[model samples]
Target: MNRRRFLRSVSALTALTAVEFAPWQTMSAFAREVEDFVRGPAVKDHPLRRISPHVWMIHSPDGFPTPENQGMMCNVTFVDTAKGLVVVDSGASVQIGEMAIRQIRKTLKKPVVAIINSHYHGDHWLGNDAFAAAYPGIPIYAHAGTIREISGMQGNLWRTLMEQWTNQATVGTRVVPPNTAVDHGQELKFGDVTLRIHHYGKAHTPSDICVEVVEDKLTCVGDVAMDRRIANMDEGSYVGTLAAYAALEKNAGSTIWLPGHGLPSGQVLQWNRELFEGIYQPCEKAIKDGLSMEEAKALVLKDPRVASRAKDTKGFDSNIGKYVSLAYLEAEAAAF
Candidate 1:
C-alpha cells in the first residue's frame, strides 16, 4: 500500500481499538491485517469432484503459478475413509487450502484426519499451514528427503518464489513442512481404507512419494506423472523415472493415477513415460552419437511421441528446452 493509504487504514484501526483490548495487542493485530489486505486477493472456493470410490479432488486448471491462479496450481486430493479424510498434497498455499476446506465442509463434512505430502515442493505442501490451523496436531506425512528439504532452504525459497510468481497473492503463506516421515512399502491404515506409500528411488524428486489407495484401486502420483503435461526432470532422472514407472506398474497395477497438476486416469503414468521417453531417448541417442545438447533437443522435438503431444502439453513451448537440457545431461551422465 502507498504511504497515505497505509496511514489511513492504521488510523481507522486505531479509532476502533477498545479500552478493554490491550493497546499493544490491537496494534500488533492491525499491522498484520494491513499486510494481508495488500495481498493480490484470496482465492475463491474451487470445485471438488470424485475421481474414484473414495478419492475426491480439486483439479487445478493451470499448470503453473501466476497472479491469476493465486498459486492454486496443484491438485488437492481428499481421501474419504471410514475414519475421516486424508489429504493427498494439501495444496499450494494457505488460501488454496482454506478453499479446499470449504469444499470439504460442503461436500463430505468430514474432518481432515491426516495429510500426505507428495514432495517438498511448496505447491504440494505449503497448505499444511491451513490444515494444521484447522486441525491442530494433524499428522503431516512425507518422505525423509521431502521432510529434510522442506525443513531447510526449500521451504523459505519456495515460499518466496510463490509470492513472486503470484505477485504477492501468496504473501501470507507459511512454510509448514511435514512433521512425519514415511517411506516406500509403508502402509497407513485409516479405518477401512489403506494408503500404501511407494517410493522408487528418484523420479521427479528424491522425495517423491506416490500414495496408493489399495481398496479404491487408485494412486496419487504427485509430480511423478502428469496428465497431458511433460514432467519436470530438473531434479530428477529419466532412467530412474522409467524404472519407477515399471516398479509402480508391477506393484499398483491398473490403478487410477491421480496427478498433482492434471486429470487422474489409468493412462497417466504411461502417457508421461512415453513423453519422457520421447524427450530422453532421443537425448540418450544423441549423447551416444557425440552430438551436442542443441542437436539432442532437435531430435526430441521430432520424436513422434513428443510431436504428437506438443500442441496439448502445457508450458511445452517455453519449458521444453530446459527439460530437454535436463534430460540430455542425465543421458550424458548415464553414458559416461
Candidate 2:
C-alpha cells in the first residue's frame, strides 16, 4: 500500500481501542467499495478440494490471521446443488471471497445462489460482501441470534478486528451480515440437495448452526468442534460444548465433521471430544478437589489425551492456560 493508504489504515487501527463498540469503522472509509466492487489486493487462488460427493472446500492452512495469511483463516466450503453452489462460509474478506469465486468458476462453473454462514464471525461471513455484489440478492442465511449479533455492533467489531489482525489486507471489505434467519431442525432443499440445520444452543457461540448435507452424510461443524486448535471459549462454555458434541453425535450419528480451519474427516468429532474431555474433565476434578486455577492448569496439561494432542494443536502452549481457567470457572459454577 502507498503511504497515504497506509496512514489511513493505521489511523483506523489506532482508533480501535477507544471506539470498539462504536460504529466508527465504515466500509466507505476502510474498504472504499464503489459500485459493490471491492478495491484491494486479491488473495492468490487456493485450490478447492472435494471432501464429499457434492461438497468441495478451499482449505486454509493457517489457523490465525496474519499479513501472510491475508485473513483467509477459515475454510470456504461450497455445496453443489441443482440451482447452484451454496456457500457454507464465505471467507474473511472480499479479496479472499473473490479468490473463492474465481476458484468456483474454474472448478464448478456455477453461480453462488445461496449462502449459509455457520456463525457471525467476520472470518466466516465478511466474504458476503463479494458474494452480495457478485450475485445480487443472493439470500445469505444464518441463525436468528447470529443475524442479530452481526446486524448489531458485532459486525463493526469483527470487521475492525479482521482488518487489524490481517494488518489491513482485509481493508475495503464491507460488513455484509447474513440476511436470512434459519433455525434448528429446518430443512432447505435446493434442486437436488437438501441442507438440514442443527443448533443445540451455545457450542462455539450462542447461535452457531451446523448445516448437514442429507445425501452426503457430512456436516459443516464450523468452530463448534474444531480440529488442530482449541476453539475460543471466552464467549462460550466448556460444559455447553461437551453437551453440543453429544447432541451432534446423537442427531447426526457419526457423520463426517468438517471444520473451518482443518482437513475434513470422520475422526474430527472424536478427536475434539477426547481433547475437550481432557481439558474440561480435569478441571472438573480439580474443582471438586478444591484446587486453584493454577493447579487445574497443571492437571489439564498432565492429562494423557490433552498431552497427546498438544504437539499437534495450534496455539496450544499459549492458549492452554486460558482454556484451563475457563474450564475451572465453568466447573466451579456447575458445582454450585
Candidate 3:
C-alpha cells in the first residue's frame, strides 16, 4: 500500500472509532476534523523559539502523534557554557537541527562542545548528522542502550509509514552512535560548569537521562516532563515512567526546569509531579480496571484537567494512549 492511501485509511479508521466509541457526541466532530488535518499534507517549517537565556525550544509545529493522526513535536535545548555550547537533544530531522545550529551561531561563536541524546528516540537523535557535519569530532553522549537501539534498527515498513503519515522527507538511513555513555549517575565537567547526568531508566525510553547543569541551576530534562502534555511511552514501561517521574520530583532541585518542549517553568518539577499524579495515574487505573482502550480514553476525556488540556489535545492522545497501553501491557507481562 502506498503512503497516502495508508494514511487516508488510518484517518478513516480513527474517525470511525471516535464516532463509534467516544462517549461525548460533541467530541466526535472535533475528533474527525483533527484526524483529517493530521493525515493531510505537511507544513513548511517549524521555526525555533528562544524561551530562556541560552535555552531555545525547537518545536515540530506538526504537534504530537495521535490515533486520529497528528504530527509529533520534540524539544531541543542549547546551553552556553564557558567551555563551549552544549546542545541537548537534536530536533526531529537534519534540517531542523541545522536550523537550530544557525540560531545558536547567531549569538555564540564557541564550537559545539557536545551533543546529548536524552534517549534513543528518532526525534531526539535523527539530527545528529547535521550537527556532526557542522562540528567535526564533537563528542556525542547517550546511555549505552540508546546507542544500541538506534544502531540496531533497520529501515523498513515502519519508517516508510512514518514518513508518509508525518509528512517527513525520506532521509538516508545512517545511524548516529554516541561516543560517551552514562550509567546510572555520572558527572560531566565543562570548564567551570558541571553537568550531572542521571539515568532514569525505562521512563520515556530505555535509556533516558536528565541533564542538570549545576552552576546554572538549570535542568534540561529531555522528555521526562513535557510542558504541553504527558510524556510519550510508546516504547517504555509504566512502572518505569512512574519511577522516573518520582525520581525527577525527588531530585529536581529548586531551579529553573527546561523541558524538551514547552516554556520553562519555575515550578516545573512540582507541576510535572502533579501532572503525572493527577492525570496519568488515573488513566493507568482505568486501564487496570480492564477498561477497553476506548473506554480508558473516555475516562481521560471526562477529567476536566485532561479535558482542559484537550483543547490543544489533537496529537497528544496517541502518546497518552500509548502510555496507557504500555501500562496495561506491562501489567499483563508481569502477570505471566
lDDT of 2 by residue, 1-336 (tens): 855366666665655543555464563343333322324568999999998898999999988999888998899999999899999999999999999999999999998999999998889999999999899999999999999999999999999999878777887888898989999999999989989999999878899999999889999999998889899888888778888888888887546899987888888888988999999998999989989999999998999999999999999999998889888888999899
Q: Pick the candidate with the highest lDDT.
A: 1
RMSD of candidates 1 onward, in order: 3.4, 5.6, 13.1
Q: TM per model?
A: 0.92, 0.90, 0.73
lDDT-superior candidate, 1 or 3: 1
Q: How close is candidate 1 to the true structure, as a TM-score?
A: 0.92
**Candidate with the greatest TM-score versus the true structure:** 1
For model 3, the local distance difference test gives: 0.65
Q: Write the per-residue lDDT of candidate 3 for residues 265-304, one digit (tens) a residue.
A: 7766555555555455555666567666667666756766
Which model is ahead, 1 or 3, in terms of TM-score? 1
Give per-residue CA lDDT, model 1, range 208-298, as digits (tens): 9999999988989999999877777878888888999999999986469899999998899889989989999999999999999999999
Best-to-worst ranking by lDDT: 1, 2, 3
With candidate 3 superimposed using the best TM-score fit, by how many Å does residue 108's alpha carbon deviate from the native? 1.7
For candidate 3, the TM-score is 0.73
